[model samples]
Target: MTISKRTLIIYLVSLGAFILAVFYFIKTNELRRALKLSEENRDSIIYALNQRSKKMSELDSLLLTGDYNSALKGYKDQLASSDSSSFDLIQQRIELTKKFIQQSRRVVNVDSVNQDTISMDTLAENTRRPTAEEIRNYDSLSFALRKYQIQLDRLKSQLQKKSYGEYLTFSSKKGNSVHYVGQVQNGKANGHGIALLNTGSRYEGEWKDNLRHGEGKFYWPDGEYYIGEYKDDLRSGVGTYYWPNGEKFVGEWQNDQRSGQGTFYNEKGEIVAKGVWKKDELVRVEEK
Candidate 1:
């Protein structure tokens, strides 16, 4: 079969077009697969965020009802199961949810319950409790408690507003006198406010019923800042503390002090020392 030049050219052109078509088809399929995978990941991220938010809501309700055990379980599960490297939005959602759950947990007072019950019963059955002045005093106390409760409710509402993600709260006390402020919700400095030390230092952050809870930032007049988790007005969990002497410590802190593994950095933000600190002192240090 002797092919003419014109026929040869036509065949070559057809073969080239056929190859281009096949290549285009494969490329389009690959692009479609990639897009599908991306969409799936996006949906997964959304689902995870939604689940975490819902858990947080449930946690709030549990906390309001004083169901700490269940709430704590949920909180721990959320923290453990969260994908920390997800998008910023997802990470924030998870962080805030965990914060709410952990913060709302009321400090259990094992001794106060029995003491309060006994005191209340004794007060109620006082044989000489018929004085008008005494009754008035009791009434005044009741009124004050109600007022406090109302204020607490309003503060919780403010926290809910802040938790929606658009506000920060801070408190300050001036002078040599010490004044306690309180813990806040949704990162607003709210709840039972207490000044820890009178030495011109302040810690402000998440608060629940006037106790420090969740992530808190504490600042001292001596040019120190501690940023990390807190429980019951104390630094507990991972945190970074900046000292006045141009040094910093970053590590897992507990009970308003450095406890566990940490790194002490020099003024240049270089890790000059690494060690386990207990009670704010280096128990062990490894120079690297």
Candidate 2:
């Protein structure tokens, strides 16, 4: 039996509605994911801002009351306990802390305040005068400020490089033996980071799509270390290899072997061999 024109039209409309519904569902999921990530980033930034604001208030109180020892002790404890990954969202909060600190410093550094035909220089100077404990506290605060500033600078560098992306740490399971910690993007270690292997060999540095790429340092379980450029997970390009037995090689490498020019040094820090090599074997020695 042939369907009537109206019936066929109704069936087509129903199929089209079904397709539209599926499209809307997929788009809505994507939007939800984006919103979730945005919310997380916002929360992290807000948390950092709150913590810094609290610290700023405490610093002001300490300075006003000359409670330098307590301030210094608390600052040190916080730094010691801070997690490395805690700064992953630092870029969002750096400006807030910097501005607050700058304003606080200015307020603290005022030399005098004018009041009712009297200059309050004496009182201001006395209040601002640094005691020994205050000096120590200021020193530690300065150091901590510099440290966080440096971290922000590194993050800025990473943003420029875009090699690691924003996320930190990429983990995998191929059993119970392997683990990784470092910069990750797109669910893989795509930036600078470290990986631990079951054999006790650990590699740290730049990565691309989960492979060791760019500059990296690999430490063998036997105490040997390879510091150099890597391509596709093999030591390539310029690098230095150090042996626990006091042997070292510095030079060009290709295809996981020494090639082109290189210098060999013994434990005495003296160059033992300088020359060309092929496939991990010395091909020619340079005339010293």
Candidate 3:
């Protein structure tokens, strides 16, 4: 097989082109795989972000409700100690308390709940401190409560003055009663506030038209409690309900009923049921 120079050159060129074609095919496949994986990762991040945002919103709303509830309860305790029955004083104090609750909502609403983005520019400001603003709010409520106390004291000193004494009031709570100090608009509980009932029940959270329409916490006298989102006064969203004995339910809710993906844990923290729920019962039993 003695080949001429021209023939050798021709054969070499054909072999080189074939090798290049093979390499190009492999490289193209690799690039496609990389692109497909990147796209999948992006989708996963987006899905995760959406889920996290919703959960964060629910939590933020719940916490705002809690803070307002605590502040109002504290103020109510102060009012009771002063034996202050002054309707005018109570109303004035309520107005002041409303300011703080309003401030808390504003502070909590600004938190963003996005994570998993690889972009260097999206700095995670996910965890935040709600302290200083909360303190200022607490002080505002406290000041108002102290004013109510002083007014009661002044009325006591003026007992001899019938005109001044007549304006003061006193209450010896007659029955197991609960107290609530929060926003009331148009004769209905609206916005954030706390409630303590005579039956030893307590609720603190947002209200709309006198219904618990947002995130809130409800505690029974027995120490059982539900903390989560509410819609139209029903436990209609994601939340956690804990029994006094350490049992708990965590997941979706609809009309005060357990619905959607939820799990029930026994007193010992063992999962009793987990899966899709309907009317408070598990529809699909998930394998542990």
Q: Give me the candidate number with maximum TM-score.
A: 2
Q: For residues 1-288, what per-residue lDDT tens digits would candidate 3 score against the true structure?
A: 799999889767765665544444444444444444444454554454354335423433443455656545544543454333334443444444455455345333111222222223432333233345544544554455455445544543333122111111111134443344455566556677655554545667877765678999987756688999999878999999999789999999999999999999999999988899999988898974
Which of 1 and 2 is the better model by lDDT? 2
What is the Cα-based lDDT of residue 85 in candidate 2?
A: 44
Pick out the ten consecutive residues of candidate 3 with the lowest summed lDDT: 163-172
Clashing residue pairs, backbone N/CA/C < 3 A, model 2: 169-182
Cα shift from native, residue 204, model 2 (Å): 1.2
- Candidate 3, residue 200: the lDDT equals 48
Model 3: pairs clashing at backbone N, Cα or C within 3 Å:
176-198, 177-198, 178-196, 178-197, 178-198, 179-196
Q: What is the TM-score of each candidate against the true structure?
A: 0.34, 0.44, 0.42
- lDDT assessment of candidate 2: 0.58
Kindly report which residue stretches of model 1 are placed more than 4 angstroms away from their true locations once superposed. 1-199
